[model samples]
Target: MEQLLDYINQHSSSGISEKDFETVKSYFTHKKLRKKQYFLQEGDICRHFGFILKGSMRQYTVDDKGAEHVIQLAIENWWVGDRESYTMSTPSVYNIEAWEDTELLMISRQDVLELFQRCPAFIETVKMMDDRNNIANQRRITSSISASADKRYTDFINCYPNLLERFPQHIIASYLGITKDTLSRIKRQLLQKE
Candidate 1:
């Protein structure tokens, strides 16, 4: 959990004293999940907010036609959760699943609210993370509506270069809102140009 503390300290403003950091840390519990394990399932309550200590996870939803649409990917040092369900105590419409053997530090909704109240610096930290997520989501939505498939794939590759090697082609295609065959053609076209 030393890395977790380091991440907080680095991201947080000077308003967070050591005591505040300790208090925030105390509320979290550690857990591990195997690859293919689920952190949250559709229709389940998302009880916890999680920080990935190691490995990766994917948040996605399945359509009526049974196609999975990737919502987001969380990697090491990133946070993952269903904010609406976790905050409101409702069922989640999405599933969060481990993409690899994963370690996480998780805090319950109650504890998260308590941290926000108790640690002033945590407010900024949380807001910063949330802002980044929101911006990324907005960009994805805009791209989906306005960009060509090849352009969207390029943007995805540029934004998450490491995922090319880390995730399977189908998952990457799903994330870019493209088919696997299209992704392959895009990759090949780019390679030919290079």
Candidate 2:
């Protein structure tokens, strides 16, 4: 996809050469999923790493009490997969599901390894994503363990403003580790402040 090429070029130290771009493109396959379809399910091995060409997806886990906890949400231009499972070839504990009819550029684990060796731009993009993901996870962990609910909600809004209208209130609340009622109160308080 052109979008994938642009994304890789943008992330690269020097934009990818046309020769490398063709190699990069060849490694990926286009995939489409309908709303409510799963890209990955718990206990399933993650076989492909996907980049969203259009639409959104959510990665979450369900507890014994049958409560879903949102771990991550991805939209256009975002990458979605169970990294640990993809890397180690283990079963994923989370489910990655499409939130809308979605189109993605997917590469198999074996192909990714081959691409990494062949395309420097693709390698750079993967490295950049890994760094960003680590930083985001660190901040999220700190916030969850120490920050107040309202403060966490505020940070979330600031970090992902566009997601407010994309996901349901309950999903947002779940992601923030807050109750629906608490999220409502927080939203009201925020509006009042504004």
Which candidate's lDDT is highest? 2
TM-score of each: 0.95, 0.98
Residue range 1-194, candidate 1, lDDT tens digits: 77777777767766567787788889999999999999999999999999999999999999999999998888889899999999899999999999999999999988878888888788778888888889998999999999999999889878888777778999989988889999999889999999
- Model 1 segments beyond 4 Å from truth? none
Cα lDDT tens digits for candidate 2, 1-194: 88987898878889899999989888888999999999999999999989999999999999999999999999999999999999999999999999999999998999988988888788999899889999999999999999999999999999999898789999999999999999999999989989
Give the lowest summed-lDDT range of ten residues in model 2: 4-13
Per-candidate local distance difference test: 0.90, 0.94
Pairs with backbone N, CA or C atoms under 3 Å apart (clashes), candidate 1:
none
